[model samples]
Target chain A: DAGVTQSPTHLIKTRGQQVTLRCSPKSGHDTVSWYQQALGQGPQFIFQYYEEEERQRGNFPDRFSGHQFPNYSSELNVNALLLGDSALYLCASNPTAFTYEQYFGPGTRLTVT
Target chain B: EDQVTQSPEALRLQEGESSSLNCSYTVSGLRGLFWYRQDPGKGPEFLFTLYSAGEEKEKERLKATLTKKESFLHITAPKPEDSATYLCAVRGTGGFKTIFGAGTRLFVKA
Candidate 1:
């Protein structure tokens, strides 16, 4: 069985540009969540998607958004990126909304220059 | 606000050393507590989940124990391969969002 997978393992963007990162959840999982991890820090929640709708969001600003396709794949979009936006983006999936256990992907490293 | 706090930003130990990492949390109602191990530049790998106080879970040489307000991840006879940043997180009964602590970086030297 395939585990969670993410696309574009690494990315470089200029300030004020936009970037899109993709994620495919682990097989048999339906709920997808995104997180941001800065260097030397634990991940911070970004948002969660279930049934193609965003269910919960963190304290991040509107510049960050995401989409979940029917196949349980997800995409995270960041607009007007700033240097602070540079971090590792992680995608996690669980079997259901009620399940707290999550499997995480390798993550996408975003570098905003 | 729900919060999670981990202690000892970093630790260094010799091989076969036994040590413990701490994670203290405060939330409305605890749904579950989680422990994860993360390698450099990689996403976190799930370790254990504790649902209630007094719950304990063991895997390999790592053991996790929970209390009303804190959790402990105890490593027994750790090796260099066990070195990584251990993260602690909590989910509340009110919502699906999980809060994570800053994590403790463990370095086991051979």
Candidate 2:
């Protein structure tokens, strides 16, 4: 009965570099979504994946991409990271895309230096 | 554009006091409104979800109520442990993307 789990509790990256963060969804969940939370701000939706296909995306640019495996795990990849990209990366999962009740992970602290 | 706005950027209350946080939202064809509690540097923890106006949900010392354009999270006899940033979010008929507000920071002092 493990909740959502994210890899690399913390990470550091240089400008223009690429970073990949991983997430394992809660058991019995089939859909996964990613969000970015800046300091003192609420999380902003990044994208969502269902059945190994990206179903929807937010206002993020092409630099932000994701992949969902058959096991329901997800990976968020940010390319050409900027200092502004420094934030808490959160992974959320639900039973389905329309479930609306999402369980979140502890989040990965990404610092783009 | 779908948007969510939470009021009183921050609030401070003494232990045993009661208060409420506000979340005003505007979305075309609303689907659901959600409340979450987030500790500093941590991801948000789901608190409650309201699907339609007049719907209410309660857990422990917290109660959440929803209206057509707004939602309220009422905390009763809050304690220091209740101190955290409360977030409001919504999902519309557009897609699975949930729009979030800036959040309200609550500090319950002992």
Candidate 3:
């Protein structure tokens, strides 16, 4: 009964660089969503993936994108990173699209230098 | 626009002190309100979920109650281990996105 898991506990990237963070949802979950938590602020929704397609997105710019594999794992890619991109990237998963209780993973800390 | 607002940016209390945190929300149609506890450098851990007005849920020393306009998380005899940021979120009907409030940071000193 493994819970949601994320890779690369921490990362450091320079401006104009690209980075990809990975996430494996809880065993029985099928929907994956990504969030960004800036310093001293709450987590903000980035986007959501289901059935290998992005279903809903937040106000984030086009530089942020995500994908969901068949196994329910997900990847969040950020391109042309800026200093403001430094934040904790969190992944949450729910059993279905309508489920309200989402299990979260220990997020990946991205440091944009 | 759907929005969630939490009060008291931060709070410090004695080990045995009791207090309550507030979360107020405005949305078109309420679906669920969620509570989560998050430590520094860690993701949020699910706490309780309230679906309708007057719904209440309890776990250990924490109790959550909901109403039409707001929710309250009551802490009883809190300990140092209870120190963490409590986040409140809301999901509205016809959407999967959960709008979160800037959490309330609690520090229980022993």
Q: Can you write out model 1's per-residue Cα lDDT over B13-36, one digit (the tens) per residue?
A: 999989999999999999899999
- Residues A2-96, model 3: lDDT tens digits: 99999999999999999999999999899999999998899999999999999999999999988899999999999999999999999999999
User: Which pairs of residues collide in model 3?
Assistant: none
The window of 10 residues in a row where model 3 chain B has the poorest summed lDDT is B90-99
Global CA lDDT computed for model 3:
0.96
Give the per-residue lDDT digits (tens) of candidate 1, residues A1-113: 99999999999999999999999999999999999999988899999999999999999999999999999899999999999999999999998988998999999999999
DockQ, every prediction:
0.86, 0.87, 0.87
Please compute the TM-score of chain B alone for each predicted structure, in the order given.
0.98, 0.98, 0.98
List runs of model 1 lying over 4 Å from the truth. Answer: none
Q: Using Cα atoms with residue i matched to residue i, what is each candidate's TM-score against the true structure?
A: 0.99, 0.98, 0.99
Count of clashing pairs, candidate 2:
0
Please report how far candidate 3 places residue A19 from its true position, in Å: 0.5
Model 1: DockQ score? 0.86
Residue-level lDDT tens digits of model 3 in B1-110: 89999998999999999999999999889989999999999999999999999999999999999999999999999999999999999999857798999999999999
Say which prediction, candidate 1 or candidate 2, comes out ahead on TM-score. 1
Write the residue-wise lDDT of candidate 2 on A1-113 in tens digits.
89999999999999999999999999999999999999988899999999999999998999999999989999999999999999999999998766988999999999999
Poorest lDDT segment (10 consecutive residues) of candidate 1 chain B: B91-100
lDDT of each residue in B33-106, candidate 2, tens digit only: 99999999888899998999999999999999999999999999999999999999998998788899999999
